[model samples]
Target: MQDDLGFDRLLDDDGFVARLLGRTRSGRQRKPLYGPDLPVVFLVGGPGMGKGRLLGCVRHDFGRFVPTAHLDCGAPAVTERVAQRPELRSEVTEALREMALQFGKWQGTGGALPAPRLYAGLLAVATSDRRSSTESLVSEVREQDGLLPPGTFWRGVLSRAVRGYLAALGGLVATPAAVPIISAVLDELLARMSREGTAALKRCYGEYPGAGGSPELGLHTLAAHFQQGGQGRENAEKFLFRALREDIEAAHTSVTGRMTRVGRPALLLDRADNTLGRRLTRAVLEDRERGHHDRLVVLATARREDGGRFLHPPGHADEGRAATWQPADGGLPTWSRSPVGDPGLASPGRGALLVRMPLLTRDQQEREIARTQGSVGTGAGGQGLPVGPGFPGSGPSRLRVETGIRRLSGGRPLFVSRLAEATAAFRMPEEGSDWDLLDAPAGTRDEQEEHAVADVLLDDLVVRQLPEELPPEQREHWLDLLSHLSVAHDADCAQALMRERQAEREERLSAYRIAELLRDCGWPHCPRHFIGDLGLRHLLARRLYGTRAGGAAWREDHTFLRDRLAGEEEGAPDALFGTAAAHRMHHHLAADGAGNGHGAPGAEAVTNYLARTFYTRETRDWCGELLAIADVPLLGGPDDRRARALGAGGTRGGAFHRRVDKLLHVVWLCEDRARTVDDAVTSTLRLLLERLSDESEHGAEVLTRVAGEWSERAGNKQALLPCACTGHIR
Candidate 1:
């Protein structure tokens, strides 16, 4: 129900459509990257990553000047409609109906959109229906009234076609049958069209399996060909989809394309990973590679990463690294060729450029905060208006909210809006400060502001988003299974846990099956990571630690994984970093409570693991691995009451145990950004540098650069302490 909140701005500045349309943010024309050939652009991200909202924004904002159409291929309404028409056997009919309507609305009277061609296809379906009569055919056309041109123009076109057809047939057509009348009307319309339009239609239809080189025959037999339902039908459907795009292109060229400026029609599809959407996209891509040319821009939202690989825009590839968003270098995202070959292509999707829909940037988050506070552009003095002081919308309060929300939401747009709205609406006590918001009680207190936000996120993003078609019992245990499995880093670990829990179920769940279910529900699937989204993973970790029957389930599960991993380490003694051993330590420390010092292997095990791998591994890779193993969410209740405690002062243990705790805190800062650097964090880095200095002459310098890198990624100012060993200060 929420509008895009200007996330559409991301798409307009040389984004998917902006690049295709050859326009900059200021509306100045630029040479299009794809030239006249439209490339399929995919917006890729995890669930709740705002793909749907971005598509909606594109349609709403861009539909004014250009012919734009949108369809949710997976929506219940669209699928239901398509299901009712088995003759079509796909969403093509439903999609074309939408496109025609949208195109008609944009062009108005005398519009050059191929309405007659679409009408011809509908007529084929109606006539092919075994239950159809002349009256039923009329009823079918009436049902599609909204998809046709204006009333006056349509009446004129139909009358002219009917009259011309009857005259050609002489007195034999005195009382024309509805079928023959409609067929003649279609033929007459096609006959009078421009040669370019006719050629496009013929080229598309000729490729149909049953067309036999006659576009006219293809038009009349489309429904019957689809009714067979096999490879032939699929091929026919492909050609038909191409024909639809061809129609759009032909219409645009004749009308918009003929003008002084060029305008391309845009098709925005949500959930384009669905079955019918895949077919449609495949048809377009295949046709393009086969040498078909058109000006119809197709932009789709995909929840899977493999739908497209992220690429930097043309000239900016050298500005920053590939496969990641660099907003500071001008945030233009696009899709590129897959790193893996065609054999490894994600099933049912390939050849399309995929750009990951980014989380809100820092600037975007601040803008949302200001908008939530009702502070528009500038004040009378040409300065920004006050965001107030001492209240929820005050500068300090907003910063606190941003820090907390960034930590909690990881900059997911929905979370940003929800938390900001909640903060703005909250009433503060006279003596209360902004810290009260961060220190709010956990979910046990349902009336607390923090609880409301957490509950909404839990239900909306996790629970309710589960595949509703799943059996009720499976749905019931899903959260518990996911919570426990969250500790798993890979499929092997996940399957180990699954086998342990098999005795509790009527049917055993494998890691593959669970992964499929999660993927179907829009969770990003990465082979190396069990749960990929940082926010969702953190939430699941919270549930694992807090929602068990005796609250001991967390330690028990960690103990189970730790013991299992220990056996693996014995089997694979040469595993780098003693991966299994390091993983075991992660679970062991979690089971014993981080920095709690009550574990079998003790702090010496962790120190040994680091000592063995720290010098051998690349610094960044080693840091990332260490962070991965240590960053378990053992903070507090669901509200994370101890969220702000990220230093050694609060950690109780021996020196090494405390160091492990501090290092985990620093790495977690990469994901859970804070308002500013705490002095304890800086001193912890300095202590780490001091330790590294003893190991090697240049080790301290390496640690300093690593700390600075973390600081940059985390947006943590003053975290890079003065290090005399490296002469580095920040």
Candidate 2:
């Protein structure tokens, strides 16, 4: 499907294996040692950061020479084991039965299947049986082979079947009984399989002999064996270690094929800090130390705190110069200085290199868009037909694609690729087309383009990272936070809002726990508060604000803005003030033009109110002084009655004076705004005073002067201001 997205190809081009192997090109084949002594290398990043893709590439490229295995550490088998308790027994029994059947089937098939295919079939059979018991099914398989005495063969069949069942269960549950039983059986079975099966299993687990098993496989050997396969316990472990040793030997071996005893494998662990628990980190370190191949090299990826935890000698490292291996000398590498850093550490070696993935330049993005669209059009046309009309033709200068890449991707490659895919699918028209640009007609080509891009991205790119099947309370929390953050334009403000939401969620969680405890003790539980993460809160908020069903009710019921206002003292003032001002501006603009007769006074009043309510005394005074000096057009022409009603009596003079007094007070209160405020306030006040100077003068000198001043202030000296005082203003 779509050439399997070519992930492997991308990784190959990116030199992932070469980097991992710690090799550089100086016209010599130099490979780093990889053995029991070396630390394990972990590639970590967010989902779709190409960790899995790089692993795939490594396997594909070195499957023959190095014997690589790739397994998803985050697989459900490892993560969901604790939740599968009730079904554990049944699951184990079913697994054994299926594996017995598979053994029989393999025998019947002459045992000639490819290792990968055989293992795949076996795994599939075991997984299927876990859903439904395969006792009868195994019998059927035997019967098909013309094997008689179902009773006589059933015992061994059942035992083998049980072993298989334990193997399946072992992957999911690390248990005393299951691990030993499954491990023993697997050891026997693996001894019987061809070399290919062994190799395949090795690749599947990413374990080599001297290299040891993945720490994700856990502490126990039996447990690891069962996790790997049901019938290959000892051999699996041996194969894993052997593969590691072989790879290390290969790396250190001279071109003449002689082994050179060098330092241990240079382990490059990336983002090891993200492991869910300390147990995992400990297990990985223990596994490496236990092997003791020679000259161990352990490289781990982690944030500073996480790395610090491991820098201390592991609890299990009791033997051989433990005192010498101090925390500081634990062979930690720092890569913070380099752009890409060493995926292995925070810093780089002298010959070490970093290749930070760069954001696509505007020109690069445009070219890519054009190339993608042109290719798609050409593919659709068949043969040598010209590509779509959107593709630029020969000209003095090539057309520039004006779409904002930063707006679309935030400089993330995954986001960029996703947006590019969406844009390509919709075939968005080239910029500056004759069609209306700002607002596209509903269901038109442009609308389809927008929808297509948003839909694909939201579904394929954004939604995958979310927790599985969010609960109602969690959903609500997510939505509320997202709504608040979405309105923030400043990056700092957005990040702060997110952090605040996270803190609030933690408090809510604590309250939820207290309520739950109360409920258990026959006390009334509060329904208002619950616990969850910020992501959950954001998700719920998004649904509430954007959806039709519960969205309206939720918005109306929740007083999030009021709550935020109450906590304004704890918030960043700049952000809070800006948000409050914007909200007020929006409300004023939306008020049906009914307030203060002419609406202008109402709008101006709202601005003044924001300056008073949200801003500090200094900011408020400065803003007030500026507004007071700003000119107010005189009542005239068709709207004269409305304007006159608004400016009734000494109300206009009072409003102007009151505003000026407020500005003066602000200037007096804040030393920072005093001198500047006078200049700003005086200019505006002078313009308004000029407007009401005289009738004849107002028509010519007053209006003309104001127009010239307004244009100059607006940085558009030739542009006319739309004056409500004019007859044609309405």
Candidate 3:
């Protein structure tokens, strides 16, 4: 977070807090900030809108007030571990372990340890065998009431807790009136520790509490009494749990009061929804129901979608106050609150205020653009802005560059930041100075020109952000992975795609590094399955995939990704068809429409593909894109005028007849099934009809027959007007 990567941060702590806890959300009334609510706030934003950066800003500002416990909860391995094992110890305990250790190591001996590395894996001090030891402690703590303070680095906690409890309970346990037995046991154990050593004392703890010689032995013997199936084990366990919890809480409170003189301490959850969702939910509920976190302000960050659980725990309903997670009191509380939910969508869940981030304003845009310009060409695998003293250094040139970036980035801070970074990265794929790419205005710029710039930016950022710096030969595989991501449709499939190629790498691209690439490329947020920014994927698709030669190679690549996904889906074809239906349809048409080699077989494939799309419910979602690309003979678009020229230049023959037949089948499908025909589709159909109807007697005859069949099968759902095929065929 304290990196010297050069870009200036946009969100300021004080101002961001004002905006975050702002009075109005998109201009609607929200619940007023209240004392009863846990200081848990969800800072919500979409991809590249500075959500990640917002977390960084909070750490800078809020860490002083709240001795921050920072965890990059979305690290791929961390997320995987939770999804697999999901024990509370693994999620929150281990995280607290990391923070305590990170801060502890930072506070080592003399000076504070260096700020914890950003996006570093979750474990901090707990490494190698420590991982196993911590996990075991977590399980033991969960099942048994542990009085062992989780604070391993904080010296004297166990000593102090044991001593205090023994002081209160020693006489009672001595004659043992009502002495806090657990504390007395810890004291006895601590006393033995000066002579016997910690390991031997701890070993003595597992022995019989009734066989107590020392307080540690007394506590453990008591524990063993309950554990060995006696009556008061539950009460004993609960007391010990409370003791442990209080000790941990006191340790945290001790640190908190000393951290800052600010109003209250805050907890900054940096995208822990996927990993710590269940734990945070419980913590907040405990704080709410039991008034545990009343003194702390817990500010958690997450993608807008995950604000639901952050706002309220699961099984919670009836305002944000009630827990269906327990039992619904039916109909609900009049004092119910709608704290958490998508404010923009007005879907309130638990009663937490939602502050959804808006796109950058003009002033903010200019500030970012200026920052971009300064950072560029720093020789940092970055794209430097413009240098021309004539055009861009002046008024109109600056305006054009600002306008192009704004147009490309849509004022989303992340996109703009990366665009600046890419510009500074120094390798311009296009021929012009950065001027044309950055200068083109919204309407004045060529679509193709804007597209090329986006692809270059995507490539630049992907490479620059990639872990383990890819070499040239493996770069192709890396590019292929990027391409595959554009079409993978979701995070799991994308990960699987990476795993598929992970085995291919021996020298580099290990399995963990491949997964870590997700966070490296600014995907620390949830909903990772879908590309955080769709425009990035679209640009990658259009650039890496081309329309030359029917875009056959492009379709081949799409099909290649699709086939691999399908194979992975194995018996669950629905897994491929249901989730990524749009992607599959796009690829299927692209590949099936590669009607070059097979004559009748190709024609049948096209017909079958069209028929299924016409009848299926899933096809409705992507029919618009299908029609847009399917107009040409292959998956190529209207921009491929050269292909149009070649197709129209032909003399009609039997082979040509089949080609025309394949092309006309789309029109026939359109006539029978399309609810609407776009001007582009109609125009392309007209040109095809006009050309083929006059080609030769046989070509005309074949065209007439297909047109007749389509006209006969035409239904009410057909476009308001028939394709020109009807008029030309006769």
Candidate 4:
């Protein structure tokens, strides 16, 4: 198995612990950030960027020096902590009591206890037998050298409490009339259990007794008050939050009692942007604001976007607009409020830091490539031995393999690691290296991105991410979904398309497949689809269905996705104007080599779609990017064997000749990307004008209007140049 040794460098950043402990270099720690208040550090990045892995590294590094709790917010036990129903609340209380052992198990022992691991061990023992009595169970466990160690006062108390808590938990439904009493019993039990558990653990950790936790209020008193007032009895979930914090603080007190450790215990919330995580962090902050101070450090992970919305971290908000409207007179504008300021809030992450993880740089990527290659089970760089099929017997010459791996992965760690593993399995491309580099130059940045995503990465991704168990039919389904997703404007649009198709599935996609697929492609967590992971989308789309499919098949799928999206978007006219316009126009052209519209009522909508993109001011910039990538490959280059195969068009060259003709005809109609409205209208008008000229199809007046629109603009600089001719343009 892969080990924590791999992440030592990432975890052991100098002063990282000092930042949390507020320690000086002189072994004297001073409070940092929001003074003496325990800091809440947020570890943030985009999805699939390995936040969870970093959390694991943190636990590994600090497991010896300090106690920590790793809470998976998505887990049912954690999330149900807020449930209001009586039975659910009982279950929650029982879970928390069992969970308290995570920190409590260090009781009477002079050592550190990482919360999750301790509790997981205790749970294994406690759950090993539901049939045995409390004494018998604890005794049996002790006899077997289970997690619940014998000969300790707190362990004995904890064993009894666990028995009672479990009994009370199971009796909630059977004793329906006593639910309020049972609920109160559970809460009081949790409060006492967590408190005593921490108290027993409060001795000799790292230089001092940590958090000194005791029953501030007795279980009997709490139970009496809850019974008399009927307050805490109403919702057993109330104590869950209080108990969670108490346990952590208790653990801290236990570790640092009497002597000043000058440091706080830590709580690591995995997936902190999720339901339980967000609520827990906010609750703690709110408690602090309400003058309920506690000495516990918190570290959580979130997506980059949520780092601001929920946690209010600095540098997360827009600092300033690159294109701000300021007065030209060299004086401050009438506006007084700071753009990023929060009223009455000096700092949003008051005592915290939001550390954003960046992707691997080129040099780092090269090192990682070298490491992966060298570790491929046989000292992969050994001399005079071929690494795999087609490899040079003396190796591919140092850095050749590294360069190839880096180019394929773009330095994203997951991709780099995944591709590296695949290479180890076999150095030859699994799908076969049909991909060729774009040797020709392109004018725009988009083409370079296209080449990287489509030409460089897609095939490798397919071979890596797709599961071996994936059936052929399902593979085709996934391909169809991916290709259509290429044109999606946002997550919502993509989701809608997926949902519509999902309804037709006879069997559901497996969760593992869904997760892997989602990881393979990034959604619109940024500025819609353009700012999304376009490289992945484009590459997957081109490889799966774009270049591989024949003419008829390509046309069929594109047309279907286009019409389905159009129909799905029929209700929201105002919302569908700009983004949908580009999709509509492109898909319409894919199926036909005709004008913008083909005379049906639906054709008018297609014409309006193109018109909307061409004319709208706000959409014009977006339209240009869309049009820049828009391509129609009618025939291959002069050197292309496929083009040569289609010799003498309009003759009996069969499928090859017909496919070539169809592509050319489509290009003849669409013209080129019109930079301005007047220029854009000519795209449609050119087709109409030509149609009219050929047979006076829409009358001379139709030709006249199209001709007038063309002249009004600068006239087409390059003709699309289509013909039913045999010889080439020469």
Please report the candidate that would top TM-score against the real structure: 1
Residue 107 accuracy (lDDT) in model 4: 35
Candidate 3 lDDT tens digits, 512-607: 454444443334322422333434544455544553465554665556655754543322333323334434444455455433322323334433
TM-score ranking, best first: 1, 4, 3, 2
Which stretches in model 3 have alpha-carbon errors above 4 Å? 1-32, 45-49, 62-69, 74-91, 97-185, 188-260, 290-293, 308-351, 361-367, 374-412, 424-533, 539-553, 557-627, 630-730
Q: After superposition, how far is residue 462 of candidate 3 from its true place, in Å?
A: 9.4
Better of 3 and 4 by TM-score: 4
- Roughly what TM-score does model 2 have, to 2 decimal places? 0.42
Better of 1 and 4 by TM-score: 1
lDDT of 2 by residue, 1-730 (tens): 1221323222332233333343322112334433233334433233233333444444444332322323333344434532443222122222222223322232211121112222222232222223333332233222222211133222333345445544544443443333333233344444544454445444544343333643213223423443455443434333333333333343344342234232223322233333332233344344433442422233333322113233443432222111111111223232211132222332112111122223344434444444554543212223334546555442211221123222334333444454444344242243221111111212223443544333343343334433222344564453344344333323443444455556745433222332232222111111211211111222233443445553443333233332343444422334322344333332232221123443344334544543354233343332333333221111111222123222322223344443433332222212111011223333343344334233233144533554345435333211122221111111
Alpha-carbon local distance difference test for all models? 0.57, 0.32, 0.40, 0.41
Q: How accurate is candidate 2 locally (lDDT)?
A: 0.32
Off by over 4 Å in 4: 1-10, 21-34, 76-95, 107-239, 247-262, 308-353, 375-410, 425-483, 489-531, 535-557, 560-627, 630-730
Candidate 1 per-residue C-alpha lDDT over 325-361 given as tens digits, one digit per residue, 9 for 90 to 100: 3233454544443433332223323346666676676
Better of 1 and 2 by lDDT: 1
Candidate 3 global TM-score: 0.45
* Candidate 4 global CA lDDT score: 0.41
Q: List TM-scores for all candidates, in order.
A: 0.71, 0.42, 0.45, 0.51
